[model samples]
Target: MHGLLSAYSPLSKVIRKKGIPYLCSPMPPSTRTPYTGSSRKLVLAFDVGTTYSGISYSILDPGQVPEIKGVTRFPAQEKVGGSSKIPTVIYYDKAGKVRAVGAEALRESLRDTIEDEGWVKAEWFKLHMRPKAITSSNPMDKIPPLPAGKSVVDLFGDFIRYLYSCAKLYITESHANGTQLWSSVERTIDFVLTHPNGWEGGQQQQMRKAAIQAGLVPDTIEGHARIRFVTEGEASLHFCIQSGLTTEALKSGGGVMIVDAGGGTIDLSAYGEGPTKGTFEEIASPQCHLQGSVYVTIRARTFLENYLRESKFVEDVEAMTEYFDKSAKLTFDSNPLFIKFGGARDRDPKLRIRGGQLTLSGTEVAAFFEPSVSCIIRAIKMQCMAAKKPISSLFLVGGFSASEYLFSKLKEELAPLGPNVCRPDSHLNKAVADGAVSFYLDHVVAMRVSRFLYGTKCKVNYDRKRADHVLRFAGVFNDVDGIPCLAGSFDVILPKDVQVSETQEFRKHYIQKAFDRIGLEAATSLIYCYRGALEKPLWWNGSSDFSALCTIKADTSKISRCLKPRLTTWGQTYYEMFFDIVLSFGLTELTAQIAWLEDGVEKRSPAKIVYDVDA
Candidate 1:
C-alpha cells in the first residue's frame, strides 16, 4: 500500500504529466495614424553642448530629408570685434540684469572692462559639476568662475534657457529656402541633451531636473515637443551611422571603439558582435574622465601667457582675460596665438598671424598642440585596451574631433591596431541628440509589435529536516492514498523576477491562501532567495529571519497584469516570479501544487508537504 501511495503521490502525478505555462501582458498604446497630407513643416533637433550647440531641422514632407543649418557657438550675433566659440561665460550688470553670456562674457573678461559691482564669472563651468575635477599636465590653473554666490546648477539652468531663447530667435529670423518664410503654427522643437554616460545616477537626475526647470518642455508640450537625453559617445555613433559612412558594414558584429573627445570630458565605449550569429551588443559600458579640448586650450593659453610675459607683450594675465577670450576664437584662423603656443593646427590657410616681421604658418600653430594631442591619444589607447576586444575600427567625434593634427596623431597611434580609424563627418557633434531621437522613435514603435508579461509563479522544495531546521517549526502531511504521514519534508512557492508592473498582484498571490489565515506579521521576512546563491537579497537588513516567509510586493498593479515583457529590455529579464509566502497553520500536514510556467505552457506539480508540529 505504501508503494502504491508513493506511485500515486502529487509529485509523481506531476512527473507523469509534463507541461509548461503561457503568460501575456497588456499591449502598449498605439502612436501611429494615417498620414494625411498636411502642410510640410520642420521638426527641430537641438544638441545642447558645454561650449557650443547645434540645431538641425527635418522637414516632415513624405520624402524630405533632414538639413543642418549653421552650427555655431552661442550668442548668435557676432561680437563687435570678437572671434567665435561661445566663451562659456555669463555676467550681470550693476542693475542686476544679465549683461552678457557666451562670447560677450568672454570678451568682457579679456578686455578687463567688466564692472566689479554686478559681475559674475564662469570658466570651464561645466567641468565643475561633474564628479571628477578637470585637470591637465599644463600650468593652466585658475578657471573663470561664475558669480560667487550662485550655484553651478543655477548657472547651467540659466545658460540652457538662454540657448532656447536664441534658437527661437534664429528660427524666426532665418529664411525658409531663402524666401524669408514665416509660419503661424508654432513649430514643435525637440531637444536632445547629451551627457557623459559615466555620470552617477544622482547627477543624471539633477541634469534632467534642471532641463525641466529651464523650460525644455511645457510641463507638457503640444504634439511631440520633448527633451531627451543621450550619452555623448552614443550620440557621435548616431551621427556616424547617419553620415553615409561605413556604419552598415561595421554593424555586422565587428568590434569598434568610439572616442568622444569633447570640451569637458573624453567618453569611451565599445561595440561588437559575439562569435555566434546576430548577437551584436554594446561590449563595454561607457567610461568618462574629465579631460578634453578645454585641457588643451588651457595649456595653450598658459604657453601663450608665459610667452607674452617673457616677451613683455602683456603685463597681467588677468588684465588680458578679454583679449585671450577673443584670441581663442582665432581657432578658425591659421596661426592663431593658441596654435602658436602649441595648439592643434588650423586647416584654413588665410588665418596667418602678423608679427613685427614674422609670419606664422599653420605648421607653427600645430606644433603647440602636438603634446596635448599625444596625451589625448594615449588616453584613448588605454581605454581601448580596457574594453578587452580587438578593435576593428576607431571612430572619433566631438568638437575636438575635427582637429586635423589630432586625427593624424590618432591614426599613427592606432596604426598597429588596424587601418579602420576614422572620424565621423563634421556633424558628429550632433550625434548624441540625433541618436536620442532615433532611440525614442524606435522604442515607441517596437512597443506596438511586441507584448510584455508581468507577474508569474514558481515553486520551491526542501528536505523535511532541512525545512524544519530552517523554519524552526514542524508540519505533517498525508500520503497520496490518504494514510497519515510523519512530519518529514516541506515545500513552498518562492517569487522570482515576476514582471508585475504594480504591487497589487504581488500582494494578492502572497496573501491569498486556500486554507490559511496567517496575519501580516507572519508574512514579513529578511531574505527571499531565488534559484541561485543568496548573496544579494531584495529586502532591507534586520527585517526578519530568512525562515520567515516574506510577502513580495510589486510597486504597482499595472506591472502585474499590463506590462508586456520584451527580450531586449533589461527590466524584463531581471525578474523571474511574482508571489510571497508565509507560515502555514491548521493541519498536521498539507500537500499541494504550486503553479509555474516551464516553456510557454502552465503546469502544476506537487511542490512540498509540510508537517505541522513543534520543532
Candidate 2:
C-alpha cells in the first residue's frame, strides 16, 4: 500500500534526473578568491556517467569572483523550463544515424517513432571504457550493447556532441546577453572531463580522441591542450568543500573521506588539510569499484527471470523489471515494493500478482543491494587502514546516493568506524558536475597518493656477487665502455602509496650508447607501470605483472650535437648520450619531459605521451 502504482513517474522525482535546479544557489563568498587571469574565459565541466550525464560551467572575469552554474535545461525533458541531468541514452536508426538522445529518447511519444523507424537503443555505454583490472559484480552480458557499426569512441562522440549543444542552448537562453557572453569566450573555453578513479591513460586517450571527434575541440595540439581530466572522487571533494559540507571537519583538524556512488562506479578518496590554510592533500590512494547502482538493477532483473520462470507472465519480466528500476529501486524503504507494470487484466494470484501489480518482499529487494553495500564497506575499511591520518567524517554524494536505503545502510555499518557518515540534502547527484568546475577554479588538492609504481625498464651493471644478477647473467652484454650489464631491470621513479606534491618531479637518469650520431637523432622512452605486489620490483621480463603504460617521445637530436665518440676497452668507437626522463604525477593527469645538459646548462624538451590504442 505504501508503494507507487506507476512506472512512468514524474520526471522531477526520477532517480536518473541527476541535475541541478534551474537556479542553483551561489557558492559561499569566502570559498575562493577573485579571478586573476589576464583575460575573460569559460570553463565547462562534463560529468558523463553510465546512466546519466550533466554539464556545469563558470565564466571567469578578471578581478571578479566566479560562480559555478549548471545547465538546467535540456532537450526532451518533461518539464518546460529545465532539468538537472539528462539520461545517458541514445537511439540510432538502421543507417547508424542518431535519431534521438538524452531525455528525448525517454519520451513516451517516442515509442511509435522507435518502432516505426527500427531504432536501436544504447544505454550504459560508458562502462565499455572501464579498465580491465576492475571487474563488475553483475554479468557484463546484461548491460546493453552499443549500436551496430559503432565503437565506444563513436558513442562518446555522439553523446558529448549532444551535451555540448544542450549547454549552448541553455547558456544563451538563461543569462543576460547570453549570446554575447558565449561568443566572447567561445574559442578559449576550457573543458574538464570527470572519470572514474580506476581509469588509466588509455581511457583518458580514448576520451580525448572522442572530444576531438565531437568537435568540442579542433584536432590540433592547442585544441587538445584545452581539455583536462579529473577523477570523480577528487572532484566530489572539491564540491563538498565549496558547498561548505566539510567546514566543521576541517575546523576540527580531522581528515574527510569522499565516496562518490554513481551509476557505473563508486570512487573512494580520503584527504587531510594541507600545511597551508584552505588547501588539502590526499591521505590515502584513491579506489574505484565497478559495483554501483546499475548493478542492483541487473541483479533485480536476474532475480525476476528465475522467480517467474514457471509463471505464464514470464514474457512480461522485462517490463516488470523496468518498472522496478525506475521507481521501487529508489523509493525502497523497510517495506514491501509493489511494482505496477500493466492493467487490471494481468492477474496471477498464485505468484502474488493482483490488479496488474507485482509485490516483492523487502528482504528480497535488499538482497539486490547487498553486493554494492558490501563492496563499499570493505573499500572504506581498507582506505581507513591505509590513510596516513585518521578519518573523522565521510561525505556521500552522487546519483546513487539518492537511495535512502543505501544511505541508511552505509551509516549503520560505518557507525563503529568512528567517522560521521552523511550526504547532502539536495542536488546531491550533481556533485561531480559542479565539483569539477570547483577543482579548476580553486586549487584545493595539493598532494596526491600514487596508485601504482611508475618507472622505466633499464639495464643494470652485472655483479657476480648478487644471486639475481648471476641468474640473469646469460643475457648479459658488454656496454660501450665494455662493462657487463643485464637487461630487464626496473628503475622505480615513484613507488605506490607515496604522497607527492603538485610541484614535485621524479627524474630517472640514464646513459644511452649508440654506434653513430644518427642513432641518437631521436629517443623514445617507454614508461612502464608495475601492478604486482612486489615491494621493490627488480625485473620485468618473464612476468605478467608489468605492462606498457605509455611512451615518452623526445627529440635527442640536440644531445647528439653535444656528444662525441668514445672508444671502448675493446677498441670499438660509440657515441654516448646522457639524458633524464622527468615525470610529474601529482596533477590530475600525468606529464613527462626529457632533460639533458648542453654546454654546462640544462636543456629540457617536452615529451609527447602516446598510449597503445588497444590498451
CA error at residue 563 for candidate 1, angstroms? 24
Q: Which stretches of candidate 2 lie over 4 Å from their true place?
A: 1-27, 137-141
Report the lDDT of model 1 for residue 119.
58
Positional deviation of 253 in candidate 2, in angstroms?
1.8
RMSD of each: 18.8, 6.8
Question: C-alpha displacement of 73 in model 1, angstroms?
Answer: 9.8
Clashes of each: 50, 3
Q: Between which residue pairs do clashes occur in model 2?
A: 19-84, 19-85, 20-84
TM-scores of the candidates are 0.55, 0.94
For each candidate, the alpha-carbon lDDT, in order, equals 0.44, 0.85
Q: Tens-digit lDDT track for model 1 on 1-615? A: 000000000110011111211111121222223223355544444454556655544333433333334334345346453222344556765544566776556553444557546455555666556643223344553456666666666666777777666556666655564223325323444555667754433344455556667766555434223555556665555444334332343554456677887766777766554333322334554567655666556655565566565443344344333343334422433443432322233222333323221133456556546655666677667656655456677777777666555666676677886636666433545555554443332211100100011112322232345543345233334322232333322222323322112111222243221111221112222222233334334322232222222223322232233223323232222212333332211111111233433454654432332211110
| lDDT at residue 1 of model 1 (Cα atoms) | 5
The sequence of per-residue lDDT tens digits that candidate 2 reaches over residues 344-431 is 9999888889998989999999998998989899999999999988898888889898787887788778889988777766788899
